[model samples]
Target: MSWTSFYLIVAGLLAFTMLLVCWPWLRRRNSMVQDSLTNVQIVKQRLEELEREASEGVISEHDRRQASDELKLALVDETSLQKEGSRTGVLPLSVGAIAALLVGIIVYFNVNQLDKVARVQHAIDALPRLSEQLAAGKSEQFNTEDVRDLALAIRQRLRGSPEDARGWMFLGRLWMSLGQDVQAIEAIERALAIDPQSTATRISYAQALMVTGEAAKFQRAQEVLQGLLSENPENDNLALMMAVVSAQLGDADTTRQYYEQIKNKLPENNDMLTQLAGRLAELENQIQDVPQGSELDTTATPGFTIEVSIAEELKSKLPEQGFLIVFAQDANSDNRMPAAVVKMPLQNFPVKVTLTTDNAMLPSYSLAQLEQARLVARISTDADVAPSPGDLEGELNAKVVAGQTSSHTIIISKERK
Candidate 1:
């Protein structure tokens, strides 16, 4: 909700409350005024009657005079009493109204934490701009202070809107961006709890679990990915993540199984298949060692020498503390998980990196498995696990020949949207 709307609602409630508190006093004051008027009218009518009676010889002048004085005294006493009652009633009502207003102000400022609300609202208002700047690779536009303020705002908002799954997810992503994996996991778990049926939220939760790099967390991530894969068997992304999780858990058999499932679906001579085959072989070699003099076969490994550069016009947009990621994946597959990947701090343009079986993201997947692959070079300002908006990226399809290192040039010409 907007701050303006919140403030308006609060003001309206306070006005309604004050009216309720003062209603009885208002009614009583009006009744007293009416009664005073009625008494004056009755006294005037009686005096007129007395004058008529005296003139008609119904009473002597002396008796009439005495009656008139008594009547006037009674009227004076009644008027004075009514005035006293009015003053007495007004004092307490005024005091009560003032006290109630003061208490309301105090409660709004203290109990409700109006100052924190204002800060939260300010952070909320600044969100879009902050996101835009960050996405644009302008890290200098924000700082730790800005992030802290935003985190505090999200926490405060969640207190009042605990059931907002999207809000929780947003907070989780924010924490992830800040490299707070534990907090990110907690937040995404909350989102998943709120929306158990959301595939995206579940995927995010699993990713957070995997980021911790713990064996137990890897098992948990595997479970989550397996569950998702069961529900949507055709989802290559889930299958790929499952393989990675299994590899992380040291489950070589499961990793190879998932690898083969994905590998079989690709076209013949796919680049990822070559990488996967070499990685699978390596996994097997780990279980059974060869003779001391015998060396592991390197002929099955696929290699790529990548030359990465940026477009001339986009050079100025490069981030100061960015990373260059080069990876090879199956050319025709919808899955984006790379069979082999390399990450290095971005320093200069025309940077060269070599990808081999050792660079495989999973132990059972490597460049040796594919005949044709999509070579990608990306400049990630935030070091995100996946490509995101404002990140510069370039890709080209290349053929993979086992035992032969291919050279390719990738020009980072476009920003991811």
Candidate 2:
């Protein structure tokens, strides 16, 4: 049964116990009232005796009357009966009620503690957020390396043969984080193939397509998403993805409908909600022509570049981005910030860039968590701005730890279009 149901059941039992504890007292009060009426009859008999003596002339009326009044007062001051009956057993009953209440409280606390399911969910929620924190560098305020380590541990659980779809999806996202477009695509496709019914997987796939693939591929991704929506329009995950894609495609009404549903449906504390809201605002601007859309042609981007200058000793076993933006992630966390990004900038590929993870960007002596993070960067670029795009190198992920700079040296020479 649910916690609420258990609580109500306990409350009802305590209320019943309270009634039982008071039952004896209620019975005693009734008995005392009945005994009081009996005393009244005894007093009447004494008054009648005094009247008889006066009628027989055995005593003067005044003297007999005085004796009768004195007897009546004596009865009132100190009842001739050994009865302190009403005071009995009240303390024990009161003590029992307090005991019952204490027991109920103990049960409540213990049962709450025993809810293993709740604890598991709490852990799950925390794991994702911790990963995000590490990526965003929020944990830099504390021991960020620890957060990075934690992310790696969680990711490890998602691995091992007989992969969980959730695990593969997480890894795919992590690949995106490390600026490894090719790996990201592989991981995401693995997840989709594992669970085609999952809208979550499809949306993740679409994000990759939008940034990494060609226009034709972008259209195909949109079609895949549309087919999913046709199966279940109200699917919250699909609705959220469609909202952004629709806005990107310049569909105002449709995007707004999805936005409205998202406001009511998105899980509290989800990062996606904020991203969607910001995008929705931009879509509004696009449709309303509020100051009109910028004439910037991001389509001109050629691609991005990266450089892996790890200490020669630590240079091997490195992952690189080619024709794709690559992302390296903490194997344990869902974080993407601690990752590095590079642009490919050529052959209509994802902004591909490269960087060395373990040697220079990371400190000589790394924090414990970063050691396990499988250290990497993410990559992406604009198509409408080539040549220069190819020359552009991505930022360093050293920002994961506070007080660190994020600048990088030129990784590629600029080539004129």
Candidate 3:
């Protein structure tokens, strides 16, 4: 249920519970007052009987007077007892009321679980907007804490809402952008399971599989894309992914076929078309360089490099298996989104890694376009691109110019609190 709905339900329940708890007290008070009034009327009726009997010579005047005095004493005793009963009840009722309030407060926070429920609900509510920011590559505006919260919130929501196909797909893409291939594959697989025929989910799943670096998985991605292309032969996205997969599989002819298909569909003089043309030329050059049976090395220059190390004292805190994230962001920007990022397995200290234009989270913003930037290297236990609690991190500042090589070393000296 949504947080707002949950809260409304809880509030209704609380109101009912409180009413129930106080009902006995309220009823007891009214009943006590009525009982006192009834007793007084009964005493008056007895006194009238005594006076009538004495007047009719049924009893002596002395007897009537004595009986009247006895009745008065009984009335005094009853009144005193009722007053004492009320006074005695005050402490217990007060204690019970206090106890009920405390229990309600505790249950609201625990059994009702308002804190986490409200947190995830808010996150789920904000997901569409957050996804827009991510697509626009406005991650620099987000902090590590926000990203971590979002990830956790998504996980929390997905647990109760497994049928949310679109949410799963978005999560899969988010993981892909964060370079968490395993998680990306898992989330996309869930999305595919929910909607097997969704073209978007299929494409995302295929891309995630390709990033796994396993020959078998890469082949699976190729098969998926190949099927997609059979259904929509002119699909540019499918063709492009097919080309990449083909090149990876050492199928030069198939790669050329897909690339040409994409090229034929694009308009001339478009920037994307020009970029594709340049990529095709590079592919051609590589194909010519390799022998008939040999594969071309597809490695390209990265945008920058970060040398990372951990302090000696913090080494013991590192886990055997985790992720190391190296990312760069514009120096003057207020946003925390990295212009480019790379994720690697946690390793020994003093590791060197590169960030490339290809690592740019958003197509519009890349490390190569920045004039000055700050690089952060973090060791995270959860494979999170963001620096969350318990993660070790460090940062270095550097001057950057598009197409110019940049390098810097950073030491992971402090743990995220």
Structural similarity to truth (TM-score) of each candidate: 0.48, 0.31, 0.51
lDDT of 2 by residue, 1-417 (tens): 566987799789878878887877888767767777787787889889889989999889899979998978877754534255445466677787788789978887887656555654454556766767668978555353343344355455664543678767776766555444555667788888889888788877877665542333445566777888788877887777677665444456777888797887767667767766665665465445323258743343221133433233322322343333343344443322223233343332222243333322222112222323333332224322111222232323332332232333322222212
TM-score-best of 2 and 3: 3
**What C-alpha RMSD separates each model from the true structure?**
15.8, 22.6, 10.7
Ranking by lDDT: 1, 3, 2
For each candidate, what is the lDDT? 0.79, 0.54, 0.76
lDDT of 1 by residue, 1-417 (tens): 777888799899988998998898889889988998898899899989989999999998998899989989998998899889889988988898899889878876677867866777788777777768868999676787687666767787799999999878878977877777777888998998899888888898888877754445777898888889889988877877777677555477988978877876777687655655655665677567532454767565778898998999889888889899888887754344577877888887889989887887666456765668999898987544465557899899999887888889999999876
Which has the greatest TM-score?
A: 3
Which ranges of candidate 3 are over 4 A from the true structure? 1-11, 26-31, 110-171, 180-183, 190-200, 229-417
- For model 2, state the Cα shift of residue 214 in Å: 7.5
| Candidate 3 lDDT over residue span 1-417, tens digit each | 555776699789978987897788879878999999999999999999999999999999999999999999999999999889888887798898889889878876677655765677677777787768879999778765567556766887788898999889878877776666777888998998899999888988998887754445767899999889889997888887887776545455787798787876767876655644554554466556443544523342336777788989999999888999888876764335467888888766689888877887654356644667888888887655644457888997887754556677899999877
Q: How far does residue 36 in candidate 3 sit from its true spot (Å)?
A: 2.9
Pairs clashing within candidate 3: 139-337, 140-335, 140-336, 140-337, 141-335, 303-356
